[model samples]
Target: MKKIETIHAVGHVLCHDVTQIIKDKTKGPVFRKGHIVTEEDIPVLLSVGKDHLYVWEKNENMLHENEAAEILFDLCRSEGMKGSEIKEGKIEVIADRDGLLKIDRKKLFAVNSLSEMMIASRHGDFPVKKGDKIAGTRIIPLVIEKEKMERAKEAAEGGPIFRILPFHKKKTAIVTTGNEVFYGRIKDTFGPVVKEKIAEYPTEFLGQTLVDDQKEHIQEAILHYIDEGAELVLCTGGMSVDPDDCTPGAIAGTGAQVITYGAPVLPGAMLLLAYYEKDGKKIPIVGLPGCVMYAKRTVFDLVLPRLMADDPVTFEELAALGEGGLCLNCGVCTFPNCGFGKGVVY
Candidate 1:
């Protein structure tokens, strides 16, 4: 750090905050610490002080915090992402569009391991909107060694360390299976629930097919939706072991690849995930357990964004969710922001 005449301190970052005061009116920082001095700032500093200011000094071996932050930003910079101007030596990376955020957690960890620097971000595979703050980078010290920045650059060499997979608009169809619903004994509530859950995604409900627990009827509905150009087919109810439950059988009967008959998550543990092939490309078909109709959030909530981005989940990945599978069922459901299904990432 260096102390210089306030007029000549232009272009240097402040080392300490300059407090401003007015009798009984205000007494707070006029210029925050780490603010870069500008030509206009001279008069402000002169008004607060006599003539001198403390500022960061240029050095060959040690780089200024802003410079270090730029290098870190460059390391992870990529399409669909942009960084803000340096503020207090910190730079925040933001998403450029609505999509599923993918974080290179392994590489992200490596970069943070370096001393005197830090990077923090939201978990990967979550949905994000335009301008959402994905990550932030900055140097811990006012300045850092040039070599540390080089190491960070090397750690994030390939494509951006963070990226977004844009969601593809999909025409969707729903199949509600249950003797009660099919026979009109009880109202079909599952169809509306599924639609509400996927409201944010680029999806439209083609139509709903209410059918009995007949496996053949369920298979027919799925095939009909695929024929109608439905990219996603969601089946609700009849997922339990009872003889009346036949949604899983119906999905398997259509020759669709069943990825998992049951997941590790509670409230949606009986969920079934599958893929149906039409022509050459495969379409996703999900069998929703009864709990989905009542639960505010479930495993389905955790996987919806990924599906909308067309990123399919694997059996092992769903199995691993058992770690953070149990929900606390808090009175106020914060969901995605909460700990439920966090195991899906770890």
Candidate 2:
């Protein structure tokens, strides 16, 4: 690549299709991709493309390919960099090993923040191993030399401290309980509601079972799900303290520790949570209140996120959900994301 001594700032960068490439006596010439052009190449470029060749003078702190790619990705996002006109200020770069380095719009391109640059240090496809740093990020000032930038990018590339997280689809299970539903009294409306909500996530049903309010029957059903490969077990109904409401007892009978029998939330406060190890693997069992069947939201809203997270639900964690656990049932319920309940992050 040939280095140019200086460049002329054409009034401004060109936009849209070529308006006109009129011939000029200056004999400016045009250079194609990979062409090493110096100051002497300017007049030649003018001749080939005619008088004006939409050219942008290089900046003293020009960003590298990967760095420029992050800027472009950020520019295209909803929270994109402000003041960057999509047409005039966009720069494109190829993706790296860890995919494209996307920059957040709120993150200003400060010299300090750009210290660590993610680069394609090694060559290969994905499925990179653990402890293998496919990409790295650091913050350095803009005063670094060009040769220094390459060295920094290279050093930051190999054995990076951080590795990209592998995307894992959320898995869930549904367990419906109630003598009325199990015995076909009310036609089991709760099962479908739970299914509808569970379907919204990238999860599988795993399996579901309908059992009477009998603690033994419900316990067997809960155990069956655990044996079948269900990490998250959601049991609807039989959650109240009424004599017939034995879902909580059944869940507890499964030898799982109940997190909380009651919560500060309304409509679904009569919730129950239990966890136990069967064959060395932990299983989560939830006794959903009757309100979950008809109410808009409740404790299930709080428990759902924890199940989807990489960690298991604990009594202390479930206990903290009471703060935002209450359900208002406002005129318009934009649940999960609204301020109504604890707001489960799907």
What is the lDDT of every predicted structure here? 0.85, 0.52
Q: Using Cα atoms with residue i matched to residue i, what is each candidate's TM-score against the true structure? A: 0.85, 0.51
Q: What range of 10 consecutive residues in model 1 has the weakest lDDT sum? A: 151-160
lDDT of 1 by residue, 1-346 (tens): 7778998988888876789898999998999877898999889888987399878877798887878888888777677889998866799999999899887877888888887888898877789889999988888887789988888877776437888999998999999998898899999888888988878788877999999988899899999999999999999988899987888999999899999998889888898999988888889999988898898888888788888998878888798889888988999988778778877545
The number of the candidate with the highest lDDT is: 1
List where candidate 2 sits over 4 angstroms from the true fold. Answer: 1-173, 342-346
Collision count for each candidate, in order:
0, 17
